[model samples]
Target chain A: MVDQVHKEFRRRDLLYSGALWLLSLIIPDPQLHYRREYRFRKRDLFYLLTILLLPLIWSDPHFHHIMVLGGIHGILALGLTLFLGYAGQISLGQAAFFGIGAYTTAVLTTRYGLPSFLAFWASALTAFLFAYLIGRPILKLKGYFLALATLGFGEIFLVMVRESPRLTGGVIGIFDIPFFSFAGFIFDTYLKQYYLIWGVLMGLVLFSKNLIRSKMGRAFLAVAASEDGASAVGIDVSRIKLGVFVIGAAFAGLAGSLFASVMSTANPETFSLNLSVLIVMMVILGGMGNLYGPIAGAIFLTYLIDELSRYQEYSLPIYGVILILLLIFFPDGIGTRLRIRLIYLISYWGRKRRREKVEL
Target chain B: MFLSVEEIVKHYDGVMALNRISLQVRKGTVKGLMGPNGAGKSTLFHLISGMERPDSGKIFFKKRDITGLQTYEISRLGVGRTFQTLQIFGNMTVVENVLTGMHSRIRGGFLSSGLYLPQIKKSEEIAIKEAKEILELLGLFGRWKWFASQLSYGEQRRLEIARGLAAKPDLLLLDEPAAGLTYPEAKQLAQTLSRLKEAGLTLFLIEHHMGMVMEIADEVAVLNNGELLAEGPPDMVKKDPGVIEAYAPRR
Candidate 1:
């Protein structure tokens, strides 16, 4: 849900800000693995700098609201990327966890008189519990079968929401959910909420990035490559996969809580297959395996959707065309692939400039 | 005996892959496993490494029964192995593939890893130092950043050795380490194995390349049709009539 932006200007710079946010989140590699083990990574330092500075300069409530949604989606996509990208597992049940979190926030704050902060954690816990219970049996299935299992899970959650009219508000959905607050400070407006959401998202981003640089992270990739090979190296493949799945579920739940607080509603329709597919599209178009790519994908898609909404009915088909175009050009996601292309261009220019200087 | 395999029998769909196969390996010595095709060479390695349970048998390492334990558990108990067909995590970096091999050696699980705790960083720094040393040993130090898949065939083979070595296993079981290497590469691998032996590491290897195996193996065990045909000093095993009949150059 975004505030209306009728300013007579193209938001190209905003799109770049998102792209740059993703581009700087690149490379936890080679240098960190060996020689300079203790030094602060320049890329990470710049990335954090970018996260804080961007919101201050862009003082549009509409842009802020849109980004608040983007941040929430960023969290969801990041979670999915860990399972799909890092651990080589897929899940279409992400929205089920999201719906649970949103409803938990809605029910607890409105009925139980619990704070939204407490409800946020409760959401994560409930999602984690569901993922653990279900992941044990369904995680054994691989490839498309696993996707089907997760899809079934999403459908089952929708049925439960519909059937439990007394608790979940049934067809009308829960409303008047209080604004997200920590201690006494309230995230009341889109600007304040933007910081709240991005703040949480940034912390998660750093945590995930750090995770991918460690021993367990390698185990995820190893499992992704080959379960037998991973086991041979003494990597506990099942535990690794299950852990990623549960963590991913927890992340989705957290995002859902944020969504409920910001939008002040919990509805069954929002957590449908379309939302799950859109999140998947973000990861695919942004990039998989690495965190920034998905976040970038989230940010990019948020703006595109905002702009295209003006066309109303035509937006859906336009979305399809754009996705195909992005994938055809950037098959591995635009973040890393575009960065690589940029690096090549820079090096080429550097050489050309040197030649010109020599000729002079 | 430092490592002992007692009558490991394995069946896949009612066909015996390993039938009552047994052998012993002394500490700090290279024990060679030789067999013809379908002679159950890799199956013996798989059972010992805990990839699959033996139909009935036991494997002891450092005086503990490791049979049927999880592969990682077996690895933690100082048993490491490579594959006949390469099992490298190709998309991962060379160092990451080896770092995965060091899984049991390092101790950062979800909580510590997610938080990026100080102790975890300390351990990671140590692990990276050690991992680099392993890569250097395999001549993959320069290209440590390269994706495992991008490496050439022989480089990937050596990368697997580098990975297996990262576990610091007391008993390393290599299944055809020289399977795809050229003559020079095989000779180089033989030297590396000898160096490892000289450093007091124990090795159990299955090799079809008799020259490399004969040069480095302290003792040899020959299997034909899932049963040990001969076991003795390399020179004596080569001379045995049974080995000559099964593993001879001509069919």
Candidate 2:
């Protein structure tokens, strides 16, 4: 009898969990869709079906463009999220790294007449080196100090891009940059660009997701929380900080290269301090420290800006209002709030079902 | 000797934290270091743990000179320590925090661990099992999944000990394990210490609670004003006039 009861309880738990997993698949939770739900929880067959069908739906030209831009922004946001969210390092120089990748790709393809494919990898490498050198001293400082240093870095990169005419083509920008090609297939249309960007984004997301669950990722979290405590437990806080910074910047650089290739241009206006601020805002508005939060922030901000272009005079005010509301209502960010609500609902329903079964 | 510290001197802006402090611990023996506050107990612990390097000293662990070695390297040499102020990964669950203590045991790098390779998975499973067992031993198994910060003050202190124990170190240095515990809690901690001693673990502890220390400590060394005042068996050290005088109420 006891064995039967225990078995029944286990069966019920499995059933309930299965149902919740199924429900999560159908629900369109913009914030919790990626990180908490899909990443950690076991997805049902329907979710797997949807994943396979997503590429087919993106075959349209307009949809493909939106998808490509989304992919680039997603990669950039994910990279920044790792540093600002998980590792607790604030970086306002992400656009600087992005600009570096763009210029590097442009100069290599247009000025040096190099293949666009090689330029992408070169851009990533250059960004990594730049981050390593700059991050060493800046990462040593915390909070406001670190922010100030990165801000200075952003401004310096912007100025350099503006002043260097021969190298960067100044404000008018570098054009006639070669398009990205993979295995001799040039990414000429929105459809090709979508597939290319999506492929890169997927690789980054998977790599970063795996990285967070590793020992190195735990060391980063430990250092972020308390440097002295982390040291006491045998973690090299400085090295971990530098490692995340470089990796994050590399991701930004990759996004920049893609952006440059898609537009066939590199310009100072494209990598402004305002763009850096926008990236930071996206990270914050989505949720700081959450892996998927930035994706939601990026998508929402992008679509909102695109839609708000109808009222050019009122767009800024509307954007400010939305940000203020998000800050006041869901301070932990939409991702965390949605996760908490889902967990609460699940547990509540579980208890109600238990009560009904007991009554029967 | 498994570990030795010789003529360690530390000065913070001419304020002597440790003046010619020296100690040794052999394999398979527990050593106690008792000292009043500002008597350089923590400073000495820091020096041994490699949190800070002494101005002049030689520290040897397992016959290897470890002077100026990093904290992580010192820990890797099988010298684990607990903080006087509770140090724990607050954001992580209790089990995760304990697994962190077993970090050095897992040889696989980030990629292997991240990919969850067969060997890495096996190691992680064993680590979780060992961590669970440690928590059970400390009577914290029920709350294993709770965040470390959610634990009560006494539980947090015990969690710190559990984390240190999970490292499976040859020598464990505990700094004031019973610092803020109630009398009953202190008594329970004494029992835990006795249990650990029976397991043949070498423990070097700094404590101010004389009652608890005398109960579990086989040998005691007392420090006052950055100098060793007494070192002997618990009974002898308890009755020593110098030990009593050093701890007596200051007017």
Candidate 3:
């Protein structure tokens, strides 16, 4: 009886996979032909539609809060993508820069009573300087060694935040941080913070798009492709690496500043290894080497974690299982895989309609 | 002399890669360096291009000692090269690959580039025009939009040369430009090299195609066991006993 049941199960599994294969082969993926064209169009539409409809669709404060968090994570992922995806450098300690940004804003606003506008720029500058100082040494290492060194930096930042009671408010962290304000307009509510973060994300995205399409961006691609070729073509490889690293850190810093202001708090726990890994995950899950991959990844993961919170104690384990299964199927990214599948389905339906018309 | 190498020696873990190699080439001449497997043609190229520093030697380009300068510095001083392995950017379009080679000439800092300033746009327009011209010059104009990886082996080899030429280099170091080309493709590459020579660009090449090398090389240097065995015109170098013995060893 056991042998009979196992045989039946195997037969069913084979049939299911065979059917999937046939369906895939019959349909066609348009992404292979128009990948770049679709990305450019879809990205513009996504930003436009969100800006127009987000306020009406997500009026609730809780939804707004989630959107705000998603926007901040989006910024962080964008920066990480430039370093990891574009420049082909792996940084596992991105949260360290985020932490520095948050801490800078928190300390500056709470202790020194600096204005929000000034504090925001100061936070980014501080993170940029930090990245520049350490990048020269750390950027020398490649691949996994670079990843580990960055992770170490993140851990060091976490420890510093925890230990420096008088400076960073210790484990309890800084509280009552002021809201981000421009001139006289204050972003005090979740609704305002949502628009603020998303607005900044849009600007940064445009800047990133321009940067990626420029001569310097080509140099980055060349460097990533081959160091010897890049140098042969007159690119200062080390300088480009360092520049991208600092720029990524600066983005993370800006995101951190916004995050601290929105939450009105800065805590060591918020910028831990878990957050660093999550940001990296967002970049990978969205897609590497593409501009909006990180944004798509950030929103998906932010919503996923939020939705999975209903599982209570089992939330993380279930999430882990889903992530692993998804990764196994779509190693390139969820966006690319979904785009291909969607295109295939549409083409399949179109072909079926044409065949029916011909028979008639 | 446009470029000269003097007693350059290199060793890797006590294995001598280049043993006191010396050579010179006049301006606008095609110099060919040929040797058997592991005869240090690549090592010599690396030393001259500043990819690797020589243990004890000096290199002069345009009469300036450039033995230990960084690769980018040497490249900026007009030393361009192509890899033995095709290093074309696989994802980027053909024109984009050549535009990458224009990195030294294009002038724009991060802010100007990020903002897409007027001057930067002008420079970019000029670069695109120049890159397209390069593609046209190499007979790859129709495939300008295709990705580098999509091109055939011969086209990719030509694309690599196009990228090197885009740097506007006074001298180009080509490492095995005809490595995987068909006979016709190799002949076409030789024609292109001859045209480049006529246009006043000095060429330093390491090729295994004896026919192609002998037909086009203004000067040929033969390396045997990491040492220069013969240096003369192609016919004279081919007739040298040491050069003949280096290719076919006695059992």
Return whichever of 1 and 2 wins on lDDT.
Answer: 1
Worst 10 residues of 1 chain B by lDDT: B242-251
Candidate 3 chain A: worst-modelled 10 consecutive residues by lDDT: A30-39
Index of the highest-DockQ prediction: 1
DockQ of each: 0.64, 0.35, 0.61
Which stretches of candidate 2 lie above 4 Å from their native place? A1-40, A43-63, A339-360, B110-119
- TM-score, chain B, each candidate: 0.96, 0.96, 0.98
Candidate 2 per-residue lDDT, tens place, A240-331, comes to: 88888898899999999999999888889879888888888888878876665687688777777777878999999998898889888878
* lDDT score, candidate 1: 0.85
Sort order, DockQ high to low? 1, 3, 2
Model 3 over residues B1-251: C-alpha lDDT tens digits? 78999999999999899998889989989999999989999999899899999999889999999998999999999999998988888767788899999998998977777777789879988889989999998999999888888899999999999999999999999999999999998999999999999999999999999999998999999887788899999999988888878887666
lDDT of each structure? 0.85, 0.81, 0.87
User: In model 1, which runs have C-alpha deviations exceeding 4 angstroms?
Assistant: A1-40, A343-360, B249-251
Candidate 1 docking category? medium
Q: Model 1, range A265-288, lDDT digits (tens) per residue?
A: 999999999889889989888877
Which candidate number would show the highest TM-score if scored against the true structure?
3
Better candidate number, 1 or 2, judged by DockQ: 1
lDDT of 1 by residue, B1-251 (tens): 78988988998998878888778999999999998999888888888888889999899888899987998888888888888889999868888888888888888889788888999889988988999999988888999988888898889989988898888889899999999889998898899889999999999999989899889999999888888899989999989998898866566
